[model samples]
Target: MNRIACALAASFLFASAAHAQDWRNHQERAQDRHEVRQDKRELRDDRRDVAELEAVLANFDRARSRGKEREMVAVESQLRQLLKQELVEGRAELAQDHAEIRRDNREVRSEQWDSRHGGDRRDLRDDRQDRRDDIRDARVEAASQSARKNIARELSSLMGSRRPRDLQRTRTLIIDLIQLARKEVRDTKQEAREDRRELREDRREARDNRW
Candidate 1:
């Protein structure tokens, strides 16, 4: 009877472990799904904001062409308010990009040190990819900062005299910002795609493991 009870206990313990692992995997898959949904929502919001910005740009262009000072003031006010949000967000994003780059550098260095000391080599490729991603993020943030500066400088001039040069400056700034917005949309869409793909792969792996 003692032997039989020991056997039953081991079996119960094994089953409990398996149940816990399965629960953990389910949680991982659910988290991935949540991330995919969040990315999609962000993409939709960005597209909407970009469309609104383009409409405001068009209104500004019309005002500039007509030399309508009052119309220009109204349009510029709208554009400034719209762009203020971007600049604020861009500042925070730039900080995050810098932080990521620093963290990636540290990870890359640690991986190199481990490799030299005969650590697992499988993680090296992933670390390199992370480093590359960090650099790309920094580049995007730099472009956004450039756009922010262009808007600030031109808007300052526009506030002073509404010179033809000030009006001319906005044409270039708005175009650059629009291009950046479109790039963000593309990047966000790709991120969402990758999240979905990862979730699919995880589900498939879990299914295979069960068999």
Candidate 2:
């Protein structure tokens, strides 16, 4: 009876341990899923940051000649913040991926060391490479999709509201026209000056002939 009781207790303890391990695995998986979601959000934000930078560059170019120094300074400040945010987010994502890669490498090393039947070590390496390639592709796809979305948003903005890009273009055309007018006025002034100088010379020659 005692032996049977002891055996039962042992079985109960083993079951409890198994349950605990299963719970831990579940929690780990949940955490991993959460991290992946956060990473994706960060990636999206990073893409937006890049798009904003491009827009800022376009605006900066337009404002450069307009003497809108205060507005330009504010925009530049915002651009710097966005750049920093992007860099920080990128570093975070890279760190997450690097940690994942390190974990995979450790697992592969352990598997290689403990394996009695080695099928193909190269296959494992290839799988790791494939995962890396997939991650890179995902990042690129995210950026591309974000860029398209930005373009759509900008187009909508232009159609729906007064866009700075359009304003800048208009301003540039006006400035160019103004410059051309100034050049024409300056040319006319030079012509008048030359005519005046020739008239004076002709009067001087006539006076000398009379003398």
Candidate 3:
């Protein structure tokens, strides 16, 4: 009975560990998606700025070709201002995009690291909890086994003097407890295995999406 309880506890711990890792991966992927969207938006804006600068330069050239000196001077001034402003804004936007890209790259690397290493501080926390559960389950199992042994010993001592029916009933009860414990342990183990499998598949999907 005690062994069964210990097995069930171990199964639960395993499931929890897998779940924590899966959740971390999900969050990392979400962040990656947001970064990608922002990068695309910035690129679109940069393209629009470049198009406007080209149009302004074209107008300045047409004014010069028409021999309109005053108009050409005005257009040239406007062109210079537009060029300077665009250059400044473009450089700033480009710098921001570069920085954002670098940040995104770092985030991807961190996510990959977690996928390979079983995920950040959460895994550490889960490991600690598993260790504590192991110790507690072990102690409980030991105590349960000891108590069962003591009960069996007392029953054996009274076996000759006690009614046959009473002895048989006590034996049956112990057997039933053992069976129940085994079933519970088996079910828990099956559930843990399923959870682990799902976690593996999820990690794979996340990796593919990132690439």
Candidate 4:
């Protein structure tokens, strides 16, 4: 019967379409798995690159031979440039991630702000701990200077003394005072360094936040 043949043909066409759809779904699934594997591979490669960079930075300055030192310097310069580029790229990625997070948060907050007061306001807070640290550093610097002056005076007095025992005692006292002054100076220097580090970190955070 022609009707039976037509029905059979329609069923065959439908079956072919189903088979093609199944094949396409399988291909899509395989493609998704391949993409995931590739992402993992890239992530591992990036981690290895970072480790290599750190090793180069750690050992780049250790060569002692004249020729080797020059070589080391050249290598270190190149490594530094490479690391700088990597760091810049990493920073840009992090900043982009931060910007995306901020944008999402802003959208959430905007809805709430609009509901509350019809004016959407975003708050941006500036960190001033660095300024406070700078003030503390100035005070420590002044104290270190005073201690250095006292140490100098003690050393001068020690140099002028005549009696052997007195001289030895003066010398010992001067040495102790000098050590104390040096310690104070070192402490002040460390505080200043820490403050500078904190300021740099804050600036970096600010830059990252800007986007």
- How many steric clashes does model 2 contain? 0
Ranking of candidates on lDDT, top first? 1, 3, 2, 4
**What lDDT tens digits, residue by residue, belong to model 3 across residues 88-197?**
54445345445544544554455555656555444334334333433443344444444444544554454333344654554454343344334324433433343344
The 10-residue segment with the lowest total lDDT in model 3: 183-192
Judging by TM-score, tell me the better candidate of 2 and 3. 2
Q: Which of candidates 2 and 4 reaches a greater lDDT? A: 2
Clashing pairs in 1: none
| Candidate 2 local lDDT, 1-211, one digit each (tens) | 9999999999997677555434533443454455445545554554455456556666766666675767666555664464345445545545655665565465455435433343235434543553464355345434533443444344334332235676565334333323433332443343334334433433443344345
RMSD of each: 6.5, 32.7, 38.6, 22.0
How high is the CA lDDT of each candidate model? 0.71, 0.48, 0.49, 0.45
Residue 75 Cα positional deviation in candidate 1, in Å, after optimal superposition:
1.0
> Can you give the TM-score per candidate against the true fold?
0.68, 0.42, 0.39, 0.33
For residues 17-50, write the lDDT of model 1, one tens digit per residue.
5675467457657866886887777788779768
> Candidate 1 local accuracy as lDDT?
0.71
| lDDT comparison, 1 vs 2, better candidate | 1
lDDT of 4 by residue, 159-185 (tens): 433455644564354344435434544
Question: Residue 187 in candidate 2 has what lDDT?
Answer: 35
Stretches > 4 Å off in candidate 3:
1-20, 101-211
Candidate 3 all-Cα RMSD: 38.6
